[model samples]
Each structure stands twice: as C-alpha cells, then as structure tokens.
Target chain A: MTDSKDTGEAGEVKKDHGVLYIGMDFGTSRTSVSASNGVRETVYSTVGYPKDIVSMKLLKKDVLFGKDAIERRLSLKLYRPLEKGVIKMGDDADAESKANLKAARDLIGEAIRIAKPRADELVYCVIGAPAKASIHNREAIIEAAREHVDSVMLCSEPFAVAYGLDWLEDVLVVDIGAGTTDLCRMHGTMPEETDQLMFDTAGDAVDAELAKQIQDTCPGAQFTVQMIKDIKERYGFVGEAAERVVVDLPVDGKPTPFDLTDQLKTACTVLIEPILEGLRRLIATFDPEFQAKLKGRVLLAGGGSMVKGLDTAVEKAMNERLGGGKVIRIEEPVYGGSNGALKIAHDMPEDFWEQLK
Target chain B: MAGFKETLKDAVRQMSFRTSLDKLKKKGVQNVNVLGVDRIIALIEAAVHRSLKSRMVGIDRDAVAESTKAEFLRLLRSNEDLQREKSQIEQARERAEEEIDLMRRELGEKRSLLRVKLEQDAMELVTRYSGENQAIAMKVAEICRSFAESGDASVSSVEERLMELVMDVVSGEREEAEVARKALQDREVGNLQRRIKKLNDTLVTTEQRLQQASTMKQFDRGISSIYREVQGLDGSDSHAGKKRELMVDLFKANLKLQKRGKGA
Candidate 1:
C-alpha cells in the first residue's frame, strides 16, 4: 500500500500513509471517473482524429478524447465504445469498437495521472462495467484498468447505480444506460446471478429505430443516429398528442420540411413494452412480505431515464397490471455509478479488499 | 708472260662459246618451259626441228622424241579439253555472281520494309498513350461527379467507385492490348503456318535428301504467356473479381513454381 499525494499541480497533498481509492464508472455512452481522496471529473466517452496527417502534425496530436472530440468530428474520426453494452466484433462495428476501447483506456489513464499518487501508493481502482458484461468483456476491462491501477475490480453498472442511490434492501433497480437496460434486484446483499436481467434494446437502439422510422416516412431525409438522439433528448415525449413535428431535413442538396409526428411517436414507443416487462419481472422476485414496498420504489438511473413521461408511462403500465408502483428518476447523471463505487471504496476496509482479490 | 697470253686466249674463246650457248638456251627455254623440261640441247632440237632435229641430234633421238612428242600431244589434248572446261567455269562463275546480286537485293528489301514498319509502330504507340490518358481523365471526372451527388458520403462509396475505375482502366487496357497483340499474333501464326505448310510440302518432295531421324521442338503455352505478358497482354478476359479468381486458379495450377495458399 502507498500514500495519496498531490504535488502542487493542483489540490492539497496528503502526508498520511493511507492508500488512495479511485472510483471509475466506465460506461458505454459516458465515463465518470473519480478518486475518493479528491480527484473526480466526468468526460464524454469519445475520441477523434484530425482530417489528415498534415493537420494531425500541426495539432501535434493524432486523436482527441471527450466532448471536444465530438465537436470537431468533420475533421476527425469519431469513436464510441460498447455499442449496446457489448463489444461488437462483426465487420459492421469492429473498427469503431476497437478504437473506442483504446480511447477509453487512454482516458482512464489520463484521469489517474491527474490524481498524482505517490510513488509508493498502491492505487486501488473500482471500475463499473455493464451489468450483463460477458466474461470476455469483463476480462478486457480488467486488463485495460490494470495498466494504470495497482489493483482493479469490475462491478456491474446497475449495481453501482443502486448502491449510489442507497436503496440496497428489497429494491428493484432499473438502469437504462445508452447501451442496454439492466434490472438488478438487491435483497440487502450481493446480487445473485438469477437476480438480474439484461435487455439489449436501450436508449441508443431507440435512437436508431427513430432514425430509421424518420427515413422511411420521409424519403430523402438525411439523418444519422446521433442527430436522432439529439432530437429525442430535446423533444422525446410519450403518452401525449403533440403538434406535428416540422423539422428541416436535407433533401436533394436542399433543406425541406419533414413532418415527423407519427414517426417520432412510434420511435419513442419502441422501448416501452420491454422496459415494462423488465420492471414487472424484477419486482415479482421480492418475497411476499416486501413486494408492495419494493414496487413503489422502482428506481431508474441513466441518461435514458431522462426520456419525457418515462416514469409516468412506466407507472401507468404497472398500475394497470401489477397494481401500483412509482417510477423514481435519478437526478445526478455524471457521477451516479462512480459515487456508488466511491461509497464502497470508502466504507470497505483495505483488509476486506485483500480477501476479495 | 707466256702463261698470261695463253690464259687471255682461253678466256676470249670461252666468252664466244658462252654467248652462243646463252642464245640457244633463251630460245630453247620458251618451248621447254611449256613442255615442262630441263635439258637444253634436247629441248632446242625438239622445239625448232622436230623430225629432222631428232634424227640428226647427237643425243638419243628415240628418248628425246618419245618424251617431246608425248608432251606436245598432251599439251594439244589439254588445249582442246581446257576450251570446254573454261567455257563451263565461265558459265558457273556468271551464274554465281547473278545469284549473289539477287541475294543482296532481297536483303536490302527486307531491311527497308522492317525500318518502315518500326516507324509506323512508334507513331501508333504515341497516339495510343495520348488517347488512353484523355479517356481516363474524362471517365474519372464523370465518376467523381456521381460520387459528389450521392447522398451517402461513406468511405465505402469512394472505395467502390475507385474500384470500378481501376477495373475499367485495367480491363480496358487489357482488352486493347489483347486485341492488338492477338491481331499481330494471329497474323504471325498464320504466316508461320503457311511457311510450315510450304516447308512441309518441300520436305515431302525432298524426303529422300533429308534425314528422317530428327524432329522439331513442340510449342509451350507457358513460354508463350511470358512473351505475351512482356508485350502487355493477358490470356484471360475476366475482369475485377473474376480476374483475381482466375489468377488464383492459375497460381494453384502452377503451384510447384508458386507460393501455395494455406489450404493448397
């Protein structure tokens, strides 16, 4: 074990011999990295390359990570990791995935450097992986984290969300991240393998569905999944009849009015049934004594939770079938998972981690 | 004094006798040289007075006459025979000179014809390069226009169009080279076939003069392809993917000389 330190670049340097605890939430859509000894920041998980070798040399860098990377995409090669919460190995998504995974590692390493731990410091990092991460993907993340941290452990994303929310007893946690929606039923202890369910259809899938619908309804509408996501984030509403969506779509080299009311509504409704099923199945797992209490405390933690009228839609669906339940949406998006990992890191004794490792 | 006087008188008589012998030797030498002889008295008497000189001469008449007469008869026979031989040699020399002149004319005609053909070929090559470049520039520009107007700007589109362009250039150049080369080759093959036919006809006629034990070497396709490709010609007409597949097949067929694929 080594002591934590901050040698004048920023922050106070600790003189104690205690080890630093770093909490990392390595999400498919975004990564939230934090250190318990006061090193934390959230960065968008994206990497970009300059237009040409000349531009790359001029910038003195080949790739850029995070929000700035997305903004300079016309002159860059943009990369996104964990498409639908799993590493894509097929020809369609292989190249983007490999680059994204590499970028994620680079980002984590950079964040660790900012912490500035002492030479003797044994950095213990807890990284949050997807709830349904395959054995191979889990190993890959561990290998990636091991490059920077002395010791690293990978925990499920929804478990981290539930831990961060502090609803550990008889609570059903439904985390809808950009990749996949995960449901974990915690009964005051470590979740059993049978206690969790994962669905591949999530926020990003909905965005793709919306884009496809828009293209089919309005021919010659130039739109990518990212653009669809932007629109969804801004005006995605369920269980309501809104005015006709009139947006400018580039058609034959000119901007044209594309009325996408039916398309938008149909697209947003794609994930409703799956989410309702996931919640119904998870809540049914609670023993008879706590079933009613657990039903009302169904927590939703992720970017997808921000979809308008999601709680209401879920509440309405549950009310009609499974009696009554409340959909609780988490306010904090950036550090939801990392905060949970930090809590674990702070509470657990160093000796307890030694046994787990 | 007496010895000196006697020596002077002997010298004067020897000089007169030597002068008379020289005149006779000179006259005798002419006929004997022709007759192929050495003895002077026998030669003189035989040449100037054959019958009378042979009988009156102190030297053996029969021996001299027998030899001289035999030589004269041989010379007379040779002169008659040489007239016929000289006529034959003159006729042969004249025919050989005529044939040599005809050969020189034929060689000149071949050299001039080859020079003219080379000049024409050089001009054709220059024209072909200019035409191909112009065609390529125009076609590439047109394809690029379609690309710019395309809705999808994916790298795949550019890759596909570029592949098409490459295929067109490669295949077109291939076809042109093949057609040109084939035309030349077919004409050459036809001419060679005709020459072979003529030689075969001559062979049939002159079979008795020829050795029946010898045979000509067979034509090799492998060696032919090497020569064709060197002149920018390919055997197969397949383009793009098909061309690659055929080349793969060819490579597999010639595996002993090639780096074999993993499966092979």
Candidate 2:
C-alpha cells in the first residue's frame, strides 16, 4: 500500500508490497539462504567468468555460480571469492583482488537471488559470518548484500547455530565449515570475543588431506578438487568404516576403483582434535558451574559436521580427554546457520530494519 | 541508455549472419578476412561520406547527408509501423482460431444429422412397403375364394391364372419404381458426402492458422512473497527478552560498521 508516491528519475514508483526476511550462511565452500517465504537454497561458493570471447559466446553468460561454475571451469576463469569463510581480498588493490571483490559481490547477489525474494518486497537479511572475521570483512559483506537487500546484519556463525537450536545458555557449538571451524560458547547473553574460537582446520583441510592421501596411495588417479569434494561429501567418515569407501577415478583415461576408507577417515578425523581443543579451552574458561553444563551440551553443526560418525568420534575423544562430555549433531547441518540467521531476521525489531535502511 | 545500446547491437548482430573462420573453412572456403561489428559500422559511415564527397558539390553534400539522416528516421518509423502490423496480424490469427473451433463443432453436428436422416428414411420406406404388401395379399386371397364359390372348376382355374398374371405385372412395376427411388437417395448421400469433405479441408487450413498463432512470445511472471507486512518478534515467546538483547546488539554492531563504511 502506497501512502504517497514520489516521482523518480523516469517517474518510476513501487508500492510498499511486503517484507522478506532472508538468512544467509556465507560459507567458504557453500553459501546457503533461508527466507521467510519458505525458500531454502544452497550453492557452492565459486564464481566463474568465461575465459575468452569464444567461451563468452558459447556459454551465453557473463558469470556462472555453484555447480555450473565448477562444471564449466575449463572454459572459465574461476574464482572462489571466499576462503576461510570471509572475502579473500585484502587492503592491497590489485587486479586479482578487485576481480575477487566483484566475484564476491556477484556471489552475494546470487545467494540472495536464489532465495527468490520478490522484486517489490523489502528484503531484510542477516548473514552468519565467521566469529573471527575482521571488521573490514563484516563491512565488505554488508556492503555487498546492501545492493540486493534493503538492510543486512552479521552474526557469528556458531552463535547463529546455537540461537537456531534455542540452546542459548550452557551450550558448546562447534561449527565445522569448509574453510574454518568456529566454536562459540552460549551463556544466555552476547558472546564476547574471548568466548569464541576460530581455526582453519575444516572441510577444505579434510579435502586437502584426502588429496594428499590419494596422491601417496592411489598413484595415477586423476582427480580434480571438485571431484574430491564430491567424494568427500558423499562418503567421508571418521572413527570407523561403514563399508569400504569405494570410488572410481580415471587413470590414463581408464576407470579404476580405489578404496578410500582409510584416507577418508584420516582426513575427516582431523576436525576432532581442533574442535576438542577449542571445546576444552572454552569450557575451562567458562563459569565453573556452567562449564559442566556446557560440556554436557556440545552442539556439532555445519556442512563439515555431515561427516558420518563424526559426532560419535568427537564424543569418544571427549570421553578420553575431558573426563566426560556429550556431543549433539544438529539436523540439517547444511542449513543450520542460515536457519538461525533467518530467525534473527524475523526477530529483529521493525524499527531497527527501518533505521538501517 | 546502456540497455538501448545493447538493443541496437543485438539488432545489428541479428541482421548479419556472421560466421567464424573455422566454419567458413568447413564449408570449403579457402580463406576469409574477418570484420568486427565496430569496423563494419565505421566502414558504412565512411562509405556514406565518400559517396557524398564524390557525387555532390559543397552544399549538395550537406543536403545529401541530411537526406540520409531523414531516410534513417523514416526506416525507424517504418519499423514501428511493422510492429503495429504484426499485432494486427496476431489478432486476425486469433479470430481464425475461433472460426476453426466453430467449424469443428459444425462438422460433428452435420455428420450426426446426416446419419439420423438416412436411418429415418430407410425405416419409413420399410414400414410403408410392408403395409402395402399385406393389403395386396389379402385382396388376392379374397379373389381366389370368390372364384371357388362359383362352383365351376375351369372358370375358377382361369380367374386364378389371370389374377396371378396381374399380381406379377404390378409387383414387377413396383420393383422398378423402388430401384429408381434408391438411385435418388444415393445421389442425395453423395452430395452430403461432398459437403462434409469440403468442411474437413477448411478445418485443416484453419488448424494451420492456429499453429502459427501458438508461436507468440511469453513474458516473465514474478513470485509472491509470504508476508504482506513485517513480522517482528512474537511477544509471547519465553526467550523474547534474551533474543531482543541479541537483536539490539547485532543492530548496534551493523550500525557501527555501516557508519564506518560511509565515513570511509
């Protein structure tokens, strides 16, 4: 409903149609969105531009994202704009950095678009950022999202997970993302800088370890990082082998099967040590009475948390080291952060959204 | 303005069927020089100026340039005229489709009516002939009984033979008339069949018109949002107080970051 109309440059105007609250998980490997309109979608955090004029004409697109970017990478100059759950560009203004910035901006737009907010709707968004993200990183994210949404805010990823689950107090959240794993302790209040720990040993690290293992053991097994990521997402496990992790890789243009059970277990289990260490430090430093409570509710979330048997493996490790601890893996680990962020967007006061706008 | 430039470029590109060198070679071309769109436009402008310089005096050159500019505007106006004509053609196509639908319904109705009329005529003839034959048989039986009642064998035999001959002659004449009537009915059926065939041909022609109309372009339909108004935090939630604090903190942080960004 339009209370008043103001003529724009070409006399363009729009009604105050509605409000759309979007929650985005801006991850290193994947970006996900959840909207109030019941739209939920995820895309890999990769952007690609066609390499040359021929490719530009053939692909018929100026840019591609997610599976298309990965699948058509040979014809593209692909850029993973985000690494370690933040924009990769630094203070130095180089060509590559500027390109990365554009790619990151496009990626943010793409993520919001996939949420499918109506053109007339006012889009208010909340993004789950890494706890250790710099102020510059937060500003960049907000700036990128502003072009597509009316207003936006950033919340720590692990805390978003904790908030999503309503485990606001006495909960230890371990969010294992692709580039970084974030650990935050919830104490029914805002988590200060000291209450959160972030580390780089995460899904990408697992992918690297798996790649290394494949190189050492399965010689001549031709694979790309994209292929490795697919395999890891499909069959990555820790602690024990459910069955033999059998996958086919091409060797000199011939298909060959490799047993990757040990490799996958070894790589996936790398998350446990960092998580346990972080959990120990956070729990040790928490309030004495709540430390036991926090230890009892170790919430495991994120895409990296999808590794089969990871929860049990981490639980088993906690028993050995922390005397006794409980580990709980969230349902829908891929959308945990986004779902929480969406809730935050919905809960944020209307005045705050208007003020930001 | 950017969009308008892209539109012009697209129009130029669509008009020119440019091919790659590799494609030309595949088509058995020995060698070909490539020309880009920018160069092609430049060459056209140069050719126009060259023609004006070579064929016209100083004032005439200016006059020719103005005429060429006028011609370009005329062409653009004609293109708009063509667009209007296209819409008119589309409306005619829609009318043709409606006529086709009407014809199809008429054809079905005509076919059913022809079949029912043929069946009714056949049933009427059968009932009439059956009644006439029954009446004639009764008359012949009465004549034979009357001759027997005269009590003379030879007279009765003579009358019976004569009656048989009369009955055979009349029956033969009736068969001839029946044959003539059947021929007339066949002619009527043939005429109806011809009309049906013509209707079928027209139906096919109109169907093709419909297929042409089906190629019309479509536009995008936007999605609808779930909320008509902003839904802030629910007041009844038990954790409303705690979530409010978190929301305020998040807002404060974002406000600061944005303020700093704007300052920068």
Candidate 3:
C-alpha cells in the first residue's frame, strides 16, 4: 500500500509528511551532520564552482563538493568559505566575499543533502556555530541554512558538545577544530562570554606549524599544505614516540623517505600550551569550590582531538601545571558537536520549532 | 479444488514457452524431439498421485492433490500480481521522469525567449535613437551652412539660436520616446519574467516530486526514529529539571536570534 492523502477538490494525492530533525556541525575544515533518520555524514567545508562553460560541460555539475572539488580544483574557482570557524566575509562587498558567501550556502546545502532527508518531511536543523562567532557571522550561517531547511537554529559549538554528552555542570570542553579551538566552561546553565574562550591556534595552525617545521628541517622537501595535513592526520602525536614516522615526499621530482617523527611531535605539541593557558584561565576564574571539578572533567573533542595520546598529553600537562586533573576525550570526536545539536533539536519544543519556521 | 485432469491441463498451459522456429535453428538445433507440455504435466501428476496413493491408504489422496493444485495456482496468481505492481511502479517512475524533462525544456525555452525579447527591445531602442540623432544633426548642419552662406553680421548668433531651437525640439521628442520605450520594455520584460519564474517554479516542484517517486521506488521504508513526534526531556532522565531549564534557555536564545535576523 502507498501512503498518500487526497485533497478535497483537486483529488490529488499528497505524500505523508514526517518531522525530521538534523544536527549540524558547521566547522571550518569539515562539516558533519546527524539526522533523525539514523544517517551521519561529514564533508570537507570546501565548495567549487566550475570556471568556464567547457569545465561546466566536462564536470556535468554547476558545483563540486569536498574531495571532488579539491581534486578538480584547476577547473574550478575553489573556495574555502569558512575561516576561523566562521564564514569569511568582509564588511565591504567584493567579488571574493560574494563567492565565499555563495560557497558557504552551497556547503550548507550539500551537508543537508547528504542527510538523505525525505522531501515529504518537515526538516528542522540545529547548527553548532563557533562560541565566539560575531552576530553578523551567526546571521550569515542562519541565512545560509534557511535556504535548505524548514527551521534552523544556532548554538555555541562547545556548548553543544557538552550538552550532547549531558555534562551540564562543572565540565570544561576543549573543542579543537581546524580554524579555531573553543574552550567553554559549562556551569549547569548557558555559557556566557566570560565562560568561553576561542583562539585561532587550532588544527590549521598546527598544519602550518608542521609545514614550517618540515621546510626548515628537511631540505628540498616538496609538499603542499594538503600533504602536510594528511601527514598530520596520519602521524600526529604528542608525548613519547611510538613508531618512526618515515614518510615519502617528493624531492626535486623524486620520491624520498624522511623520518618526521620528531618534527610531528614538536608540531603537535603546539596545541598543549595554548590549551593549558585557556584551561588555567577558565579554571582560575571559576568559583573556588567547583574549580577542581571543572579541571577534573576537561573533555577533549573535535578532529584535532583524534591525535594519538592527546588525552594523556593534556592530562600530563594538567598534572604538572594545575596541581592534578583528569582529561577525557569523547569517543566520537567528529560527531560530538553534531550529536549534541541533534539532542538539542530533539529536546526543543514543537512550538519553538514552528515559531522559528 | 478442481479435477486432477483439469489442474494438469492448466499447469501445462502455464509452463509452456513460445519460441520461433528461427530461434531454435539459430541455436544449431537441426531437429528437436517435440513433447507436449500437457503430456509431461500429466505424467508428473500421475507419478505424484501414484506415490501418494501407495504411501497412505486412509487419507483422501484426491483431496490432497486438489489442495496442492489450488495452492500452486494461488502462488502463481500472487506472483503475477507482484509482477504487475512492479511494472506499474516502473511506469509511474518513467512518467514522472518524462514530465520533469518536459517541464525543464519548457523552462529553458521560456528563459531563452525572454532573453531574446530583451535583446531585441534594447537593439530597437538603440537603432531608433541613433537614426533620430543622425537626422537632427544633419538638419542642424544644413541650418549652419545656410547661415554661413548668407555672410550676415549676426550669422553666428542666428546659427546659435537655430541650433538651440532644433536641439530643444529634438530633446523633447527624445525624452518622450525614451519614456515610452522604457514603459513598453518594462511591461514586456515584467510579463516575460513572471512567466519564466512560474515555469521555473513548476519545474522545481515537478523535479522534487520525481525525486520523491524515485526514492520511494528504490528504497524500502527508511529506519524510523524512536520517537514519532517531537519529544522534550524525558521524565526518567536524572537531570530532567536541569535539561528542561537548559532547553528553555536555548529556545530563548534562538528565538531572540531569529527575531533579530527577521528584523534585520
């Protein structure tokens, strides 16, 4: 049997409509989504528009997404629309700004599309934005998502992570994304401005640092930023070395193997000091009684948290710096923010959703 | 439940395959041993009946055979119904796709027509204005030449007055023409734009419908969520009160943000 409803006069059958809730983490390097339909997916926060008619014909699409965009970048006017976990736009209108805005919109649309939403469904989305994103940036994100959803809302990224895990009180979240790292102190209520800290020393910064380190140490090493990113993702670690990270890189057009264990360790260690400083500030400024609880429940999340031994390293640094503390990394680092947003979407009242719509 | 012979006859008819003589020949078969499908069916039925008849004496063997035939026929009919349903779904999908294509083509044609009309209107305005300007310039030049040939002391003054008078009349005409042209162009372009927009909306709606149909035809029911409707905080949750309060806070924040966005 088919599910359909008939109109009174037109006698046309309409499909049944269901409510679908989606949670999205719109990050700088990657965008991840979790939907009510048991679908979870992620895409690089990159969008590309074909450069010319010939390329358009060849590509057979007006836009390319994620890895496809990166691989076919020569034929496309590529755009990484988000910088520092917010849509990169200037006050003055320019071609680059317009393109970035379009890309951000397209990227949001693409992220929603991968959720496999049914057309005959009411789609409500909650997006986890940067904790310190400006009002203009928040509006831009909301406007972009509005084009693809029935109703959408924005929440602070680190707050979402904590909410998803049901850690309401005295827990500190360190969400290290590609563009920005957010440290939010949850105190059983909404986090305020002073309760959160954001900085640009995140995954992208680490990549830049790693690339610089390689360039300075390894002579004639030919590697791009992407290559450096891949190396970091595969071999980035702090603390003691586990195995020698000997990687093949082109040198003067020839493949050459270089041991990058020390370089990677040094580069990844850049996250520790800044994170410690942020932790010290949040912990020190907190109520004296719950400061220890906040320090003990420091949660490491985001793509950068996937680095091997990061939790242990952070704990080690905390023990040395803040008397003694405990650190826990979320099991699903990539989906933490998205899952939290989904939970919020679920808990949100229907009237609220309708009003937003 | 029919007679055994009749059931056999039906089974034979259902099992028979029709083929052309050329097809058999193409398969390199010079001659084939022909056996009637009904004869084979009868033999199989007879063997089954004989085996059953010997295996049990008290049981109603004829009834058993009849029920078996009825079940087999029922299954065959159900299979036919399923096949028909599949074919109908395929047809529906095909029709939807065709409708989408038609809508797309119409939208494309309407857009191109709009573009051409705009271009034509622009070209007409440019050509008409250029001709009018050229004629006005020629008349002015003739007036100046006449003044020069007279060799009067006030020739330059007369030429200047004549030029001003000609230019004023030309300018007034040009202004009227420009206003009329703009009004006409705007009306035509507005109508075309409305039509194109309608066509585009129709195309998009149709494509969405087609996609929905295709998805339905391709996938089974998707994984359903645990909650059928909107759910708030569970009462059993340990921090139900806290989560509810947080929900309220989140809602307030979003409500504020959305209201601000709308105001902007």
Candidate 4:
C-alpha cells in the first residue's frame, strides 16, 4: 500500500492533490455553504453548550447546533454569536465576547464539517462577508474559518450575489438578509466602498415591528421574537393580501387565534421605503449613462427577499418614486451568495490558491 | 517521476494477491515469463501516453502527460488514506472484541464463584443446625432420666412433670436456634447478593461499551466527495475572466487582513 504519509501535511511532500473549494455565506440568522463536491447545506447560526454535568450526560453531546440547539436551549448555555451580519464580539474584550468568538469558530467548523470534505484533498474556502464589516470583524471571521480550511478568503455578500448570476456590469443587487439589507451596484469591475450600502431595516426589524403591532392591537397575546420571526417567514407578504394570517398565540395559557393580516402587511411594508431610498442613493450616484441600466436590472436576493410579492411591490414603488424599474428576485435567494463564492473559488487561479496555502 | 513510479508499483503490489508455487501450478502450467521491474514500468508509461495521444488534441502532449501522472499520484494517495483508515478501524474492532471476551470471561468466573460460596454457606448452616438440634435432644433426655431416678412424688406425677419440663426446654431451645440461624443466613446471603449484583452491573456496563465500540467501527466508513479530482472553472463559462479577477482581489484583501492579524 502507499504509505500513510501520502495524506500527510500539505508541504511535507509534493504529492499531487485535488482541491476542495467551499463557498460560505455566514449570516446572522443562518450559515450556508456550497462546496465543489456538490454539497449544499444551510444551518441556523445558533450554538449551544450543555450547562452542567447532568445536562452533558443527558445530552450525550458536548455541543448542540441549529434547530436542536434552539429546541433544547433551556438545558444549554445558548449563544447566537452573530448580530447585524457580523460576529457579535462586543466593544469590550470580556468573558462574554470570548465565548461568542468561540461559538462563532465552532459554528464555522460545523459548517465546514457538513460539507464533508475528503481528508486527502486540499480545502480552500471563500466566505462572503457584510459589505460594511469592520477590519476586526473580517479578521475574526478569517481566523475562525482558517481553523477548518487550508486557505480562506472573504468577499462582499451582495457583490457575490451579483457575480454568481454572471451580471458583471450595471446590475443592482439588493440582498435583504435577517440582520441587514445590503445594496450593491456592479459595473464591470470589483465594487469599491462607494458602490455598496447597508441598513438594518430588514428581516429582524420586520419581526420587531410585527411583534409591536401584535402587542398594540391583540391584547393578552403572548409570543417570543423567534415565534414572531417564524410567523413572518411563513405568512409575510406586502401589496395585496393573499389570505388572512390568523395565528394562534397563548393567552393566559389558552390558545387564541389573532387576525394578524394587517399587522404583518404593515410590518413587511416597512422594508420598501428604506430599500427604495438605498436604491435611489445607488442609482442617483451612478454614472448618468448607466442609471437606467442599473435600475432595470435590480436583483432581489437573500432570506428576506422570500417575502411574497416583494418584487412586485418594489417594482410598484420604483414606478412612483424613480420613473420606472424592474425588480427580479433570484431563483434561489438563500444560496445566491454561497453559489457565487463557489464560482469565485472555482475560477480562482491555482497559483493564488497555492500562495495562500 | 521515479518516486511516482515506485508509488504506483507499491499500489499495484498491494492490490495483487500472493499464492504458493503449488497453488499456482495447480491452477495452470508452471512456466512463467518474467520481466524486469523497470521494463514493466516503462511499458505501462508508454501505453498510457499512447492512449492519451490517440484521444487528445490541441493540448500539449507533455502537459497531458504531467497531468495524467499527477492524477495517478493523487488517486494513489487517496487510496492509501482509505487503506490506513480501514486498517485503524479494523484494529479498533479487534480490540473491542477482545475486551468484550475478557469481560464475559470475568463475569462468568464471578458468577461461578458466587454460586460456590453460596452453596458452601448453605451446607455449613445445615450442618451447624443439625448438630445443635442433636445436643438439645440429649440435654432433654438427661433431665427426664434424673427426674425418673429421684423419689419425690408418685410415679405418674413425676412422669408428667418430667414431660412438661422436657417440652418447655426443647420448645425454647428450638425457637432460639431458629432465630439465630435465620439472622446468620440473612447477613451472609445479603452480602453475597450485593456482590453478585455489583458484578452484574459491571458486566452490563462493559457490554454497553463494547456495543458502542462496535457501532463506531461500523460507522467508520468515511464520507465520499462528489468530485474525485480538482475541478477548475469550465472554460465555456462567460465570466471566467471576471471571476478570476475577483478571485485575485479577494486573495489580496484576505492576505492583507491575515498579515495584520499576525502582526497584532
């Protein structure tokens, strides 16, 4: 048999090896990965550790992930380690920050593990980060990913979406993610800082607005942020109402159905003005010759884009506000960034990969 | 190139089976044509190159040859990794089997020892109780004899008194012996029962561990990737150049960030 050293460390021997390219979209609400091996998976960005010895024994696992973590959160020291589309390491360096960093690292490792890379292949990864992520936040992400991959790189999230769709020039992408909405304009080149815009008026904000509306209108209704977010994901829409969203909430430990159709519609409508504002800023600031092209090819992507009739609503808003425009939602909103990053990883020259290693 | 050839030879040898001359002769005629190892290796290389040249065009022959060699070496390395993992798992399974066997043997020995001790204690209790009963009977007979020999009352009255005394003494002695025997038996049996229970618990725990180890061994087959070799971007892709440029930009940014992190 060939010696065990054949699969040894990267530089130990000059054995010809295959490269496993992985593209990751790490978001506040979910982390998705697309690998060259054709594995695509998305996980909720939640990590949990058993609280004590008894819990650890009962769980039979040191850590729980995603939905399992959420379900068993009471028995766990749960951490949702990302906020506003970046690692939530608070300004001060403290125990909580360190714990969050660890959770982020673990979450990244779990994302890679789910890709199921072969041990004999070299692993190179590309991660799509928030456009406005600080250097420290980017560095933290790199450090976390480096533990699981041989080499890693980062790109802007909305730009990755645009790139994945092969729209290199005069295409505007609005990625409505859980924590933030990122608007990036592509114009035949890598976008500069001025080409992108970010704001927090996205999925989480809609959940908060919906929760507030419920509290104001539906007396004695009890719910959590997670429950409200789930409700929005299931029945959220703008423009014409498809159907009434009548959901049951516990009222004094009794199941009570509340008519939240108007509330949900109002909460979801909050995204339009801010998104149009972002669009106006990007389209108005672009070169006058390409403004029409940018407006006509506006692509809606991300989890928040999954809201029903959002594209038509955005199109309607664009007609009244900025002459006229077309809004097109991507075929796969959740996998857009990761798919683009995978394309980048594939097209990356071998020398660049080798140098990074 | 020499190392690659040697690795290929090793892989070939590993895949081939060994047999004795007697078995070979039984299967076929004995005479064999032997070739030098170097000659065999040269022939294989020439055959691969000729095959590639027949099917390929536009790409340089040398580049094709190099890539073929690289692909061959990569497959060989992957095979080697799988082999190593298989060997490790096999060893683990064997170790778990041995541990389970030892535990079973120990459990059997402990059970047999407990049974023997319990049987010996029962025998000793039976022997001691019979001996005490015989002594009590003799004492009762002696009191009756003394009462008959002494002249105190009428014969019939003396006989009735003797009988009553004998009955009372024997009845009291029998109750005392029964209680003592029961207490002794309960203490010894309780101690032995506790030991047997402890051994049974240990046996169950060891069996569970063995079961876990076996399950792990069964699950040791590593996950397989969809692509067997490196897959670069398809040449027909329209944005290959643009994507390449983006890749370069991304690399430069990450390099700077990583460098800064290291500096800090």
Cα lDDT tens digits, model 2, A194-234, are: 99999999999999999999999998999999889999999
- Sorted into a CAPRI-style docking class, model 4 comes out as incorrect
Instruction: Name the weakest run of 10 consecutive residues (lDDT summed) in model 4 chain B.
Output: B219-228
Each candidate: RMSD? 47.5, 17.3, 25.8, 11.2
Runs in model 2 deviating more than 4 A are A1-11, B1-221
Tens-digit lDDT track of model 1 for A1-357:
011242211112222345667777776677776675566677666767788987687665667777777777777877775677755444454665667668656766655655554433456677777777776566556656666655566677777777666667667887887888888887766676788899877788778888888867888788766678778877776778456677787888799988776777777787779988987877776687888988888887777777777888888988998999888878875677788776555444444344323
Q: Which stretches of candidate 4 lie over 4 Å from their true place?
A: A1-17, B1-215, B218-235
Supply DockQ values for each candidate: 0.00, 0.24, 0.14, 0.18
Model 3 clash pairs are none
> Which model is ahead, 1 or 3, in terms of DockQ?
3
Q: What is the TM-score of chain B in candidate 4?
A: 0.69
Please provide, for model 2 over B1-264, each residue's C-alpha lDDT reduced to its tens digit, 9 standing for 90 to 100: 343334445546756685777898899999767787766666766787888898776556765666555544434444455457567667867798789889989899889978987898789879977887887778777766866897665866877767786878598769968986776668667877888999999998888867766554221113556878888888898999998898888888888888898789
Worst 10 residues of 3 chain A by lDDT: A6-15
- Clashes in each model (backbone N, CA, C under 3 Å)? 2, 0, 0, 0
How high is the lDDT of residue B114 in model 2? 86
Kindly report the root-mean-square deviation of model 2 from the true structure over all alpha carbons: 17.3
**Native-to-model Cα distance after best TM-score fit, residue B150 in candidate 3, in Å:** 99
Report interface Cα RMSD per prediction.
Answer: 42.2, 6.5, 10.1, 6.0
The digit string of per-residue lDDT tens for model 4 on A142-167 reads 88897667788889999889888889
* lDDT tens digits, residue span A235-278, model 3: 99998899999999999999999999999999999999999999
